[model samples]
Target: MKPAEAYILNQPEPFKSMLMHLQILIEGTFPDVDLQFKWKIPFYYLNDKPFCYLNPSKKKGYVDVVFWVSAHLTKYNEYLISENRKVVKSLRYFKLEDINEEILLTVLDEAHQLKDKGFYKRS
Candidate 1:
Protein backbone atom coordinates (compact mmCIF):
# COMPACT_ATOMS: atom_id res chain seq x y z
CA MET A 1 0.00 0.00 0.00
CA LYS A 2 1.08 3.62 -0.53
CA PRO A 3 2.36 5.67 2.38
CA ALA A 4 -0.61 7.98 2.08
CA GLU A 5 -3.07 5.11 2.38
CA ALA A 6 -1.11 3.62 5.25
CA TYR A 7 -1.17 6.91 7.12
CA ILE A 8 -4.90 7.31 6.68
CA LEU A 9 -5.56 3.72 7.66
CA ASN A 10 -3.50 4.07 10.82
CA GLN A 11 -5.25 7.22 12.02
CA PRO A 12 -7.91 7.03 14.74
CA GLU A 13 -11.62 6.87 14.07
CA PRO A 14 -13.62 9.51 12.19
CA PHE A 15 -10.36 10.71 10.71
CA LYS A 16 -9.54 7.32 9.30
CA SER A 17 -12.94 6.83 7.80
CA MET A 18 -13.12 10.36 6.55
CA LEU A 19 -9.68 10.24 5.02
CA MET A 20 -10.52 6.92 3.45
CA HIS A 21 -13.54 8.39 1.77
CA LEU A 22 -11.45 11.31 0.46
CA GLN A 23 -8.75 8.98 -0.77
CA ILE A 24 -11.30 7.01 -2.69
CA LEU A 25 -12.84 10.19 -4.04
CA ILE A 26 -9.50 11.59 -5.21
CA GLU A 27 -8.47 8.33 -6.82
CA GLY A 28 -11.77 8.02 -8.59
CA THR A 29 -11.48 11.57 -9.87
CA PHE A 30 -7.92 11.40 -11.13
CA PRO A 31 -6.74 7.85 -11.46
CA ASP A 32 -3.24 8.94 -12.46
CA VAL A 33 -2.66 11.48 -9.69
CA ASP A 34 0.05 10.71 -7.15
CA LEU A 35 -0.41 10.79 -3.37
CA GLN A 36 2.33 11.97 -1.03
CA PHE A 37 2.45 11.76 2.75
CA LYS A 38 3.95 14.99 3.94
CA TRP A 39 3.48 17.44 6.83
CA LYS A 40 1.81 14.65 8.80
CA ILE A 41 -0.99 14.56 6.26
CA PRO A 42 -1.78 13.00 2.92
CA PHE A 43 -0.84 15.49 0.20
CA TYR A 44 -2.15 14.59 -3.21
CA TYR A 45 0.35 15.25 -5.98
CA LEU A 46 0.06 15.93 -9.67
CA ASN A 47 2.91 16.41 -12.11
CA ASP A 48 5.28 15.79 -9.20
CA LYS A 49 3.92 18.75 -7.23
CA PRO A 50 1.76 19.17 -4.16
CA PHE A 51 -1.91 19.45 -5.05
CA CYS A 52 -4.06 18.92 -2.00
CA TYR A 53 -4.05 17.30 1.46
CA LEU A 54 -6.28 15.53 4.00
CA ASN A 55 -6.24 15.76 7.77
CA PRO A 56 -8.54 15.15 10.71
CA SER A 57 -9.16 18.07 13.02
CA LYS A 58 -9.53 16.60 16.49
CA LYS A 59 -11.12 19.67 18.01
CA LYS A 60 -13.47 20.41 15.15
CA GLY A 61 -14.15 16.70 14.77
CA TYR A 62 -14.21 16.88 11.03
CA VAL A 63 -11.92 16.00 8.17
CA ASP A 64 -9.92 18.83 6.57
CA VAL A 65 -9.62 18.65 2.84
CA VAL A 66 -6.75 21.06 2.20
CA PHE A 67 -5.58 22.52 -1.03
CA TRP A 68 -1.90 23.04 -0.20
CA VAL A 69 -1.48 26.08 -2.45
CA SER A 70 -4.90 27.55 -3.06
CA ALA A 71 -4.39 31.27 -2.59
CA HIS A 72 -4.67 32.14 -6.25
CA LEU A 73 -7.75 30.29 -7.37
CA THR A 74 -11.22 31.75 -7.10
CA LYS A 75 -13.97 29.79 -5.37
CA TYR A 76 -16.87 28.48 -7.38
CA ASN A 77 -20.22 26.97 -6.40
CA GLU A 78 -20.14 25.72 -2.78
CA TYR A 79 -16.40 25.00 -2.83
CA LEU A 80 -14.62 27.43 -0.54
CA ILE A 81 -11.72 27.93 1.82
CA SER A 82 -11.94 27.84 5.58
CA GLU A 83 -10.62 31.35 6.06
CA ASN A 84 -10.51 34.56 4.11
CA ARG A 85 -6.73 34.97 4.25
CA LYS A 86 -3.88 33.32 2.38
CA VAL A 87 -2.62 31.25 5.31
CA VAL A 88 -2.98 27.83 3.68
CA LYS A 89 -4.93 28.98 0.64
CA SER A 90 -7.15 25.96 0.07
CA LEU A 91 -10.47 24.45 0.96
CA ARG A 92 -10.61 22.76 4.36
CA TYR A 93 -13.14 21.07 6.61
CA PHE A 94 -15.69 18.42 5.72
CA LYS A 95 -18.40 17.02 7.93
CA LEU A 96 -19.87 13.58 7.29
CA GLU A 97 -23.32 15.02 6.63
CA ASP A 98 -21.91 18.01 4.74
CA ILE A 99 -20.11 15.69 2.37
CA ASN A 100 -22.35 15.74 -0.66
CA GLU A 101 -21.34 13.35 -3.44
CA GLU A 102 -21.75 15.91 -6.18
CA ILE A 103 -19.93 18.58 -4.22
CA LEU A 104 -17.01 16.32 -3.52
CA LEU A 105 -16.79 15.33 -7.15
CA THR A 106 -16.83 18.95 -8.23
CA VAL A 107 -14.07 19.89 -5.82
CA LEU A 108 -11.88 16.98 -6.78
CA ASP A 109 -12.33 17.68 -10.43
CA GLU A 110 -11.45 21.34 -9.92
CA ALA A 111 -8.43 20.38 -7.84
CA HIS A 112 -7.12 18.19 -10.62
CA GLN A 113 -7.79 20.90 -13.13
CA LEU A 114 -5.93 23.42 -11.02
CA LYS A 115 -3.03 21.06 -10.58
CA ASP A 116 -2.89 20.19 -14.27
CA LYS A 117 -2.91 23.83 -15.21
CA GLY A 118 -0.19 24.67 -12.65
CA PHE A 119 -2.37 27.21 -10.93
CA TYR A 120 -1.02 26.38 -7.47
CA LYS A 121 2.35 25.43 -6.01
CA ARG A 122 3.81 23.90 -2.87
CA SER A 123 5.07 26.37 -0.34
Candidate 2:
Protein backbone atom coordinates (compact mmCIF):
# COMPACT_ATOMS: atom_id res chain seq x y z
CA MET A 1 0.00 0.00 0.00
CA LYS A 2 1.10 3.57 -0.59
CA PRO A 3 2.24 5.66 2.32
CA ALA A 4 -0.84 7.88 1.87
CA GLU A 5 -3.12 4.89 2.19
CA ALA A 6 -1.24 3.69 5.22
CA TYR A 7 -1.54 7.09 6.82
CA ILE A 8 -5.30 7.00 6.58
CA LEU A 9 -5.55 3.38 7.55
CA ASN A 10 -3.42 3.99 10.64
CA GLN A 11 -5.42 6.93 11.91
CA PRO A 12 -7.49 6.49 15.08
CA GLU A 13 -11.19 5.79 14.79
CA PRO A 14 -13.67 8.35 13.51
CA PHE A 15 -10.81 9.95 11.58
CA LYS A 16 -9.80 6.64 10.04
CA SER A 17 -13.32 5.87 8.98
CA MET A 18 -13.88 9.42 7.79
CA LEU A 19 -10.67 9.54 5.80
CA MET A 20 -11.43 6.22 4.15
CA HIS A 21 -14.86 7.39 3.12
CA LEU A 22 -13.49 10.67 1.76
CA GLN A 23 -10.78 8.92 -0.23
CA ILE A 24 -13.40 6.75 -1.86
CA LEU A 25 -15.63 9.68 -2.62
CA ILE A 26 -12.83 11.76 -4.13
CA GLU A 27 -11.55 8.93 -6.26
CA GLY A 28 -15.03 8.06 -7.44
CA THR A 29 -15.80 11.65 -8.29
CA PHE A 30 -12.59 12.23 -10.22
CA PRO A 31 -11.17 9.08 -11.68
CA ASP A 32 -8.23 10.96 -13.19
CA VAL A 33 -6.99 12.55 -9.99
CA ASP A 34 -3.43 11.84 -8.91
CA LEU A 35 -3.20 10.85 -5.27
CA GLN A 36 0.14 11.37 -3.59
CA PHE A 37 1.82 11.69 -0.23
CA LYS A 38 3.05 15.30 0.00
CA TRP A 39 3.97 17.35 3.02
CA LYS A 40 3.30 14.11 4.88
CA ILE A 41 -0.39 14.23 3.95
CA PRO A 42 -2.67 12.96 1.20
CA PHE A 43 -2.71 15.46 -1.67
CA TYR A 44 -4.91 15.19 -4.72
CA TYR A 45 -3.76 16.69 -7.99
CA LEU A 46 -5.67 17.38 -11.19
CA ASN A 47 -4.35 18.35 -14.61
CA ASP A 48 -0.85 18.28 -13.11
CA LYS A 49 -1.76 20.91 -10.53
CA PRO A 50 -2.68 20.80 -6.89
CA PHE A 51 -6.40 20.31 -6.28
CA CYS A 52 -7.04 19.40 -2.70
CA TYR A 53 -5.78 17.49 0.31
CA LEU A 54 -7.08 15.36 3.15
CA ASN A 55 -5.69 16.22 6.54
CA PRO A 56 -6.40 14.44 9.80
CA SER A 57 -6.36 16.85 12.70
CA LYS A 58 -6.07 14.36 15.53
CA LYS A 59 -5.54 17.03 18.11
CA LYS A 60 -8.69 18.82 16.97
CA GLY A 61 -10.59 15.56 16.57
CA TYR A 62 -11.60 16.24 12.96
CA VAL A 63 -10.54 15.79 9.38
CA ASP A 64 -9.99 18.78 7.12
CA VAL A 65 -10.65 18.54 3.40
CA VAL A 66 -8.67 21.51 2.10
CA PHE A 67 -9.12 23.13 -1.30
CA TRP A 68 -6.05 24.64 -2.96
CA VAL A 69 -8.16 27.01 -5.04
CA SER A 70 -10.88 27.83 -2.63
CA ALA A 71 -11.05 31.49 -3.57
CA HIS A 72 -12.86 30.71 -6.80
CA LEU A 73 -15.55 28.67 -5.11
CA THR A 74 -17.81 31.66 -4.72
CA LYS A 75 -20.93 29.54 -4.85
CA TYR A 76 -19.73 27.40 -1.99
CA ASN A 77 -18.17 30.07 0.12
CA GLU A 78 -20.59 29.45 2.95
CA TYR A 79 -19.36 25.89 3.25
CA LEU A 80 -15.63 26.65 3.50
CA ILE A 81 -13.41 27.24 6.50
CA SER A 82 -10.93 29.92 5.39
CA GLU A 83 -9.10 30.22 8.73
CA ASN A 84 -7.96 33.68 7.57
CA ARG A 85 -5.86 32.19 4.81
CA LYS A 86 -5.52 33.90 1.46
CA VAL A 87 -5.64 31.07 -1.05
CA VAL A 88 -7.02 27.97 0.61
CA LYS A 89 -10.22 26.94 2.30
CA SER A 90 -11.20 23.81 4.14
CA LEU A 91 -14.22 21.76 5.03
CA ARG A 92 -13.99 20.26 8.47
CA TYR A 93 -15.61 17.02 9.52
CA PHE A 94 -15.71 16.11 13.17
CA LYS A 95 -17.80 13.00 12.68
CA LEU A 96 -18.37 10.42 9.99
CA GLU A 97 -22.05 11.27 9.90
CA ASP A 98 -21.30 14.85 8.90
CA ILE A 99 -20.25 13.98 5.40
CA ASN A 100 -22.64 15.56 2.90
CA GLU A 101 -22.42 13.60 -0.30
CA GLU A 102 -24.17 16.14 -2.53
CA ILE A 103 -22.26 19.15 -1.32
CA LEU A 104 -18.94 17.39 -1.39
CA LEU A 105 -19.55 16.10 -4.90
CA THR A 106 -20.60 19.52 -6.12
CA VAL A 107 -17.55 21.17 -4.68
CA LEU A 108 -15.28 18.53 -6.11
CA ASP A 109 -16.89 18.83 -9.51
CA GLU A 110 -16.57 22.59 -9.56
CA ALA A 111 -12.98 22.50 -8.42
CA HIS A 112 -12.15 19.90 -11.02
CA GLN A 113 -13.73 21.98 -13.73
CA LEU A 114 -11.61 24.94 -12.72
CA LYS A 115 -8.34 23.05 -12.77
CA ASP A 116 -7.39 24.10 -16.30
CA LYS A 117 -8.77 27.62 -16.02
CA GLY A 118 -5.82 29.02 -14.00
CA PHE A 119 -8.03 30.60 -11.36
CA TYR A 120 -6.22 28.79 -8.60
CA LYS A 121 -2.73 28.70 -10.03
CA ARG A 122 0.15 30.02 -8.00
CA SER A 123 1.71 33.37 -8.88
Candidate 3:
Protein backbone atom coordinates (compact mmCIF):
# COMPACT_ATOMS: atom_id res chain seq x y z
CA MET A 1 0.00 0.00 0.00
CA LYS A 2 1.12 3.55 -0.65
CA PRO A 3 2.29 5.58 2.30
CA ALA A 4 -0.67 7.91 1.85
CA GLU A 5 -3.13 5.04 2.09
CA ALA A 6 -1.22 3.64 5.00
CA TYR A 7 -1.42 6.97 6.80
CA ILE A 8 -5.20 6.98 6.52
CA LEU A 9 -5.46 3.36 7.58
CA ASN A 10 -3.27 3.90 10.62
CA GLN A 11 -5.19 6.80 12.09
CA PRO A 12 -7.08 6.31 15.35
CA GLU A 13 -10.82 5.79 15.16
CA PRO A 14 -13.25 8.55 14.40
CA PHE A 15 -10.31 10.15 12.56
CA LYS A 16 -9.60 6.95 10.69
CA SER A 17 -13.22 6.56 9.66
CA MET A 18 -13.52 10.20 8.70
CA LEU A 19 -10.35 10.12 6.60
CA MET A 20 -11.47 6.98 4.82
CA HIS A 21 -14.85 8.51 4.06
CA LEU A 22 -13.23 11.68 2.74
CA GLN A 23 -10.77 9.70 0.62
CA ILE A 24 -13.67 7.89 -0.99
CA LEU A 25 -15.58 11.09 -1.64
CA ILE A 26 -12.60 12.87 -3.15
CA GLU A 27 -11.34 9.97 -5.26
CA GLY A 28 -14.88 9.14 -6.35
CA THR A 29 -15.46 12.68 -7.52
CA PHE A 30 -12.16 13.01 -9.40
CA PRO A 31 -10.82 9.86 -10.85
CA ASP A 32 -7.72 11.51 -12.27
CA VAL A 33 -6.40 12.92 -9.06
CA ASP A 34 -3.10 11.55 -7.71
CA LEU A 35 -2.84 10.64 -4.04
CA GLN A 36 0.64 11.25 -2.69
CA PHE A 37 2.25 11.36 0.73
CA LYS A 38 3.63 14.85 1.16
CA TRP A 39 4.68 16.87 4.14
CA LYS A 40 4.07 13.63 6.02
CA ILE A 41 0.35 13.84 5.18
CA PRO A 42 -1.93 12.61 2.43
CA PHE A 43 -1.99 15.16 -0.34
CA TYR A 44 -3.94 14.94 -3.57
CA TYR A 45 -2.67 16.43 -6.78
CA LEU A 46 -4.47 17.25 -10.01
CA ASN A 47 -2.42 17.65 -13.17
CA ASP A 48 0.67 17.62 -10.96
CA LYS A 49 -0.56 20.65 -9.03
CA PRO A 50 -1.61 20.84 -5.45
CA PHE A 51 -5.32 20.02 -5.25
CA CYS A 52 -6.22 19.19 -1.70
CA TYR A 53 -4.93 17.30 1.30
CA LEU A 54 -6.38 15.15 4.08
CA ASN A 55 -4.94 16.12 7.43
CA PRO A 56 -5.95 14.16 10.50
CA SER A 57 -4.85 16.11 13.53
CA LYS A 58 -5.04 13.63 16.38
CA LYS A 59 -4.19 16.21 18.99
CA LYS A 60 -6.79 18.66 17.64
CA GLY A 61 -9.41 15.94 17.36
CA TYR A 62 -10.40 16.80 13.79
CA VAL A 63 -9.59 16.15 10.14
CA ASP A 64 -9.02 18.96 7.70
CA VAL A 65 -9.69 18.57 3.99
CA VAL A 66 -7.58 21.46 2.88
CA PHE A 67 -7.81 23.17 -0.52
CA TRP A 68 -4.90 25.08 -2.03
CA VAL A 69 -6.73 27.56 -4.24
CA SER A 70 -8.97 28.95 -1.57
CA ALA A 71 -8.65 32.54 -2.76
CA HIS A 72 -10.63 31.73 -5.90
CA LEU A 73 -13.40 29.71 -4.32
CA THR A 74 -16.67 31.65 -4.51
CA LYS A 75 -19.31 29.22 -3.39
CA TYR A 76 -19.65 27.69 0.05
CA ASN A 77 -17.42 30.24 1.70
CA GLU A 78 -19.47 29.77 4.84
CA TYR A 79 -18.36 26.18 5.08
CA LEU A 80 -14.61 26.71 4.39
CA ILE A 81 -12.37 27.52 7.31
CA SER A 82 -9.28 29.70 6.81
CA GLU A 83 -8.14 29.87 10.44
CA ASN A 84 -6.04 32.96 9.63
CA ARG A 85 -4.26 31.21 6.79
CA LYS A 86 -3.94 33.14 3.57
CA VAL A 87 -3.31 30.65 0.74
CA VAL A 88 -5.54 27.76 1.80
CA LYS A 89 -8.85 26.94 3.40
CA SER A 90 -10.35 23.73 4.67
CA LEU A 91 -13.49 21.90 5.68
CA ARG A 92 -12.89 20.60 9.17
CA TYR A 93 -14.79 17.68 10.62
CA PHE A 94 -14.73 16.31 14.15
CA LYS A 95 -16.61 13.10 13.48
CA LEU A 96 -18.11 10.98 10.71
CA GLU A 97 -21.53 12.64 10.96
CA ASP A 98 -19.98 16.08 10.59
CA ILE A 99 -19.09 15.35 6.96
CA ASN A 100 -21.82 17.18 5.10
CA GLU A 101 -21.77 15.47 1.72
CA GLU A 102 -23.55 18.23 -0.16
CA ILE A 103 -21.41 21.06 1.12
CA LEU A 104 -18.24 19.04 0.75
CA LEU A 105 -19.01 18.11 -2.82
CA THR A 106 -19.89 21.66 -3.80
CA VAL A 107 -16.77 23.10 -2.22
CA LEU A 108 -14.67 20.42 -3.85
CA ASP A 109 -16.14 21.12 -7.25
CA GLU A 110 -15.45 24.79 -6.79
CA ALA A 111 -11.85 24.15 -5.80
CA HIS A 112 -11.34 21.67 -8.62
CA GLN A 113 -12.39 24.31 -11.10
CA LEU A 114 -9.67 26.57 -9.81
CA LYS A 115 -6.89 24.07 -10.21
CA ASP A 116 -5.61 25.45 -13.52
CA LYS A 117 -5.73 29.04 -12.33
CA GLY A 118 -2.82 28.76 -9.89
CA PHE A 119 -2.86 28.52 -6.10
CA TYR A 120 -3.91 31.90 -4.79
CA LYS A 121 -5.46 33.75 -7.69
CA ARG A 122 -8.61 35.76 -7.02
CA SER A 123 -11.77 34.58 -8.78
Candidate 1 structure quality by residue, lDDT tens digits, 1-113: 87888888898876777778778878887887788878877887777777777767788777767765555445453466656655454445445556666766666676667
Best by lDDT: 3
Q: Which ten residues in a row have the lowest lDDT in candidate 2?
A: 114-123
How well does model 1 score by local distance difference test? 0.69
Q: What's the candidate order when arranged by decreasing lDDT? A: 3, 2, 1
State TM-scores per candidate. 0.78, 0.92, 0.92
Candidate 2 — which residues are off by over 4 angstroms?
116-123
lDDT of 2 by residue, 1-123 (tens): 988999989988999999999999999879988899999999998766789999899888989999988877865678889888888998889999999888888888888888568654555
**All candidates: CA RMSD in angstroms?**
3.1, 2.2, 3.2
Q: Model 3: clashing residue pairs?
A: none
Instruction: Give candidate 3 misplaced runs (Cα > 4 Å).
Output: 116-123
Model 3 — which ten-residue stretch has the worst lDDT? 114-123
The whole-model lDDT of each prediction reads 0.69, 0.88, 0.90
Off by over 4 Å in 1: 75-79, 84-94, 120-123
